[model samples]
Target: MSKSLLNHILLLVLLFIGIILSLSLGSVSIPFKEIIKSLLALSVENSTWDYIIVNYRLPKTITAILIGSGLAVSGLLMQTLFRNPLAGPYVLGLSSGASLGVAFLIMGAGLLSGILGEFIFSKWAIILAASGGSLLVMLAVLSTAQRVKDTMTLLIIGLMVASLTSAVVSVLAYFSNSDDLQLYIFWSFGSLGNLSWQEVGILASCWFIGLGFAIFCLKNLNALLLGENYAKSMGVELKSNRILIIVSTSILAGSATAFAGPIAFVGLAVPHLVRQLIPTNDHRILLPSVILGGAILMLICDVIAQLPGNENTLPINAVTSIFGAPVVIWLLLRKRKLNF
Candidate 1:
């Protein structure tokens, strides 16, 4: 077998193990045997164990997988589209836009209730707000992309747009009641455990469609890596591909922030981490490799955040940056140059 194929198979094994470990090692620490039994709908000895597995852990596990892979793929697209080693999904400011959306819902919902009604108070409301905010930013960026010739110039516009949105969120927070402020703070810390199956289904749908865009653009992505002029020579439609890339990024990054509350480092770190293993610029290989690598890393982080036997858990957002930042630094230092 080819070496890359062997590596992929190994990664698949690791992914399976990560999923089971995430299921088994939460605060209550269910046994692996019981986890398997519960998953198959056979009763565990304790009803609470079954309840916890079905209601909490399963949805959470599925969420981690989606958030991890989706964010990583979004990062890959950004990195390739801009051809910048430092480029990431957040560079486009979709996260900030999503944050602004959720901030309005959480901090300003009461003021808008008479005008917009109670729709802002629903569970799905947060997701919609975030998506709507992201859509607005996406439209602005798309408009800028059309006017700007240089990709770097377009990236700069995205940064400015992101900054404006972030400032607005901060202003909203300053006027918010303490209770609302606290709710926003906890949401920013990020959570993978509270999603219902229905929320997961919505997140999963967004993830699927976002990935479909990335998959469709794989050829253009690889061609664009060398240069846009080169890609043009190769018959890649620059404008259409650019839209696909941005829209895919908006969907993935936006939905992830919406559901999971702004996970840090995963989108930026996972693609680089995969490059350290697979050593490829080809999106076809990098996409799947990064997807699995992202899911595995997220699962690992989730396992640590659960704090095993302890009742208290670390904030997942902090845990990701804590664990992932060091690894990324070490990898870059050892390599002495980023792959891309």
Candidate 2:
């Protein structure tokens, strides 16, 4: 086999090993045999081991995989659309938009309860609100994308919108009661442990839809990498392609943020990591590699968050930022001459 194909095979094997290691290395360590038994849906030799693997470890691992794939794909799409290596869903404020929605839900819950007189705000309600908030911001960005000819200007506008959302969230936090404030603070820290099975299903559905759309646009993305005029000459409709990218990216990024509370850096760093590993900009290979790479990185991070040394888990966002920020800095330094 060619070297490139061999490298890909090796990477896949490493990723599989990473997943298995992550599943087995938590505080209540389960043996590799137990993990395999759990995966096969067999009754583990130890019943408690079965619960740990099946209930806690499995869900956490799956969540990391899903969120990682979603964020990485979102990042890749953003980078291609803007032709900026540093572009990511978080940088464009999709996560901030989701954060705004969640903030509103937390602050407004008391008002909602007072108004409805004994009706509690369900998890579904918060999720819907967060999705709505993200959708609104995305629509605004999409509208702005049509009006602005400069890609850099659109990126700046996204940042501005993100700042505006943050300002609004601050105002909400100021007026919020202590209970709500504490809850909001915890949510903002980002955790995979927060997901219910239903929420996971929602995130997964949105991720698949977004990923499918992105896959459809791979040719256009590849063409655009050569620049807009060149893409136009190749019959790639720039406006339609941009719209498709925006929609897909918003859904993928927004859903992850809404459910997981604005986990950071996966989108921005995972694509670059994948490209470095594969040494190709070809979207066909790059896209899937980035997706798998993201899943592996996230699973590893989630395992770290559990922190075997302590009973308490670290925030998922904090762990990602620790890894992601340096990648962003290196990209910036490497491309110092390139314009955003």
Candidate 3:
């Protein structure tokens, strides 16, 4: 077998192992046998175990898979589009923009219970707010990117945008009641377990559409590796490609931030990690490898967050940053340069 094929198979194996571990090894340990039984629809001695596996564990596992794959793919797109190794979904300020939107709803409007008055939070309202905020930031970034000559300059602009939005959020939080502040704080921590089945369906659908766009842009992406001038010489349409990339990224990153609350590092770190493992620049291969790599990383992080056999869980964002920051640092030290 070819080395790439062998690598693909190994990644698949690792991903399967990750899925099994994620399903069976949480705070309440479910035996591997019980997990298998539950998945197969076989009767288990304890119905509660089955319920926990099917309802809680299953949804969490699916969320991990979807978020991981989506963020990784989105990161890959940004990296390729900008020709910058460190570029990620957040490089365009999408996450901070989403946070700003959510803060407006949760803090500015006092949506949380006991904040100022009795009010129930609506999931759709939050989603729409988050999406709208990120989309607006994306449009602003895209416009600026077109005018910028240097990719690094565009990246710095994104950081500036993120900082500005964060400042806005801070001001909103200061004026908001304590209860509302707490609500926004919890959302900022990020979680993988809060998604309902209906919400999952929406996330999954958006994820697939984003994936479709990525796949369609594979050839354009590969062409871009040779630089924009070379790509245009080969008849690649830069404008259309950029628009598609921005749309795909907005969908993937927006859905993830809206649903899971700006979980970090997966997008920024996963593409670099996958490249280290696969040692290829081919998007066709890198794409699937990144999806698998992201899923496995997310599963491991989720397991760590659960603090196995304990009642308490860590924030997903904290765990990801703790584990991923070192990898990114090491990658930078070794490469000592951006590919672009």
lDDT of each structure?
0.90, 0.82, 0.87
TM-score against truth, every candidate: 0.96, 0.91, 0.91
- 2 or 3: which has the higher lDDT? 3
Task: List the lowest-lDDT window of 10 residues for candidate 2.
Answer: 331-340
What is the alpha-carbon RMSD of candidate 3 to the true structure?
2.7
- What lDDT score goes with residue 66 in model 3? 93
For candidate 3, the lDDT comes to 0.87
List all candidate RMSDs to the true structure: 1.4, 2.7, 2.7
Q: In model 2, which regions exceed 4 Å deviation?
A: 116-121, 326-340
Candidate 1 residues 1-340, lDDT tens each? 9878888998899999999889988778777788889999997988899999999999999999999999999999998999887788889888888889889989997888888787876768887887888888888999888778788898888889889999999999999999989988887898888899999998899999999999999999999988999999989888889999999998988888888888999998899988888888989999999999989999999999988889999999999999999999999999997887
TM-score of 2: 0.91
Model 3, 1-340: lDDT tens per residue? Answer: 9888898899999999989889988878778898899999999879999999888999999999999889989999999988887788888899999999989988878444556343336767777778889988998988986787665677788899999999999999989989989988898999999688888899999999999999999999999999888998999877778778878988998899988889899998898887766788989889999999989899989988999889999999899999888876888689784333
Q: What is the lDDT of residue 44 in candidate 3?
A: 87
Clashes per candidate, residues 3 or more apart or on different chains: 0, 0, 0
The residue-level lDDT of candidate 3 at 242 comes to 79
Clashes of 3: 0
